[model samples]
Target: MRQVIVLGAGLAGSFLACRLLRQGCHVTLIDDRAPMSASRVAAGLYNVITGRFGSKTWKAETLLAELDAVLKDPFFQGVSQFIHPIHIYRPFKDVEEYNQWSGWSAEPAYHQLVKFEERPLFPEVIHNPLGGIRILPCGWVNIGGLIDRLQDIFRSNGGVVLQGSIPYDQINMGQKTLTWKGEPLGFDQMICCEGYRIRQNPWFEKLPVQPNKGEILEIESEGLDQLPFVITKKVYMVPGESGRWIVGSTYEHLFDDPGPTEAGRAQIEEQLRLVLKVPYKVVGHRAGIRPTTPNRRPILGSHPQWPFLYTLSGFGTKGMLAAPYCSRLMTAHILEGAEVPEELRITQFKAFRPT
Candidate 1:
């Protein structure tokens, strides 16, 4: 069996570890239990349609299809209490946006993803005066809960262990060998799924990782109790159980702290006002850093200088939807020598490598 050490127990790490475990690898999953990870604060939303222009997301069909299959698999079913699939409703901002959506909704590519012929006008509970489009195969994942369940499952199988993060300097990745703490470690590979912390990873600091801090607010609003689908306008308002909605998020590229900021809260609140027609009380606030890349593709593959050292991070805002598909690809690449898609390959960025 291949021995593997997967770093960071967030979305990407958890998915990669699970895949490696299934491949019969002896895995040790490490995490520092930091709140700085994107998985922790991520809304865990999976949307096939995104952006102001309503363009298709990267590999949405493949990723969403895989997500549907995996979420139904017996193994995933047992550990996926944190997952729930719901449709999404994107409110048309005006006549221009409405015409655009109406035009696109009829196209062969988008017709299948929609639930309605024309844009549906929601009830007065929501402020969708210009109507909205319903996007199917959308959902949210409770990542923290998913991580805990994954750890339990991994531990129960006796093939995986969860431990504190390892010191960076302790790992010496040679072509044919890996040593930890000045001792030989019998692992075929070490995959780094270090999330936002990837920017600080000594082996991959030059890979063009930009950590963006995001904030969200959970609010209690009885008026929106009937909202079964996620509502997106200025900001997304995801319906939660018991008359609650998760409203967020503000993206700040150059933040000094990962914690929620007043400015971020204000920004989210302003967007919330624009979308939500109901009065709501803020019940909670959260913030975390997202591991975004310049081209907004996943940063994956092995280090050029050390083949044993692999990276499986930089899923960014789409971690919930992208991690599973990317993890499968990464596992196949490591075990079966499958090809890593060029967009996600780490070597695409021709930057400096530490000697």
Candidate 2:
């Protein structure tokens, strides 16, 4: 059996590990954190329609089909993977931007799903000036719960998890072993799924890492209990279980600290207050850095020289949509020598080297 070691048990690592395990591979997954990752902080929104200046979501339709297929697979039964249509109310702050996306995605399937009929603003509850339309086959992921369950499933299947930091310098290519906590573990291949931390990696020193810091707040409110759906304006209000809701997220690219910032907190509150007419209490706040690449595409593939070295990260803000698809692709490339899609290949980095 081919042995694989996955570094960083984040969304990419955990999901990919599960796939590999199902394929009957011996796997060891590691992460410094106990369990939670940026995935935990994410609202896990998967939208087929996205882009600011009017660009199509990268392979969203294709990915969503795969996600739906897996959820229905007998192997995934009892996992309770639920997917639902999420209605997005994006009030066109920039009409020019809205017009730009109007003609994009000429695909027949996408065109069929487009509903030209909708209200500009919600009649009740809130206000919208620019008008909004809805997108289908999009919704949230139970990421934290998914990861926790994956951990249990992984351990039960004889998969190993070493929970602690594994320094990149400790991987001896010539020796083909990783020394973690003074224990030397050998594997056929090592795939680093470390998120923002990979920016400091020497081997991939040139991989563009635009650390986008995002903050989100969970709140409890009364009279807003009617919101069983997702709402989006400047900020979004996603319905959580009970009377709680998730309102977020402010994006700051140049921030140094990953901790929740007072400015970000205030910004979200202001946005929430504007969109939400009802009173709400801020119950929790959290933040994390999204591992965005310069090109905004996931970085995947094996090192040209060191075939044993690989990576499956850089899912960016769309990890929820990107991870599941890319994980399957990465596993296929590793196992069957399948060609990595030109779009996501790490070779897109001209300056990257295996050594």
User: Among these predicted structures, which one has the highest lDDT?
Assistant: 1
User: How do the residues 29-89 of candidate 2 rate in per-residue lDDT, one tens digit apiece?
Assistant: 9888732257767877777666654345877678888777667776554444534455655
**lDDT minimum window of 10 residues, candidate 1:** 115-124
Worst 10 residues of 2 by lDDT: 112-121
Clash number for model 1?
Answer: 0
Compared with the true structure, all predictions reach lDDT values of: 0.80, 0.75
Question: lDDT tens digits, residues 1-355, model 1?
Answer: 7788888889888888888897789988878888767887878788999988888999989998888777787776565567888899888878887788778888999887875425445455777777778998788877788887877777777655645656776665654444454665667788888887887789877777788888999999778877778988879988764456788888888878779878888999888787776788999899988888888998778888777788988887898889889999999999988998888887777763334
The TM-score obtained by model 1 is 0.94
> Model 1 segments beyond 4 Å from truth?
116-122, 175-184, 241-243, 352-355
- Which pairs of residues collide in candidate 2? 120-131
Best candidate per TM-score, number?
1
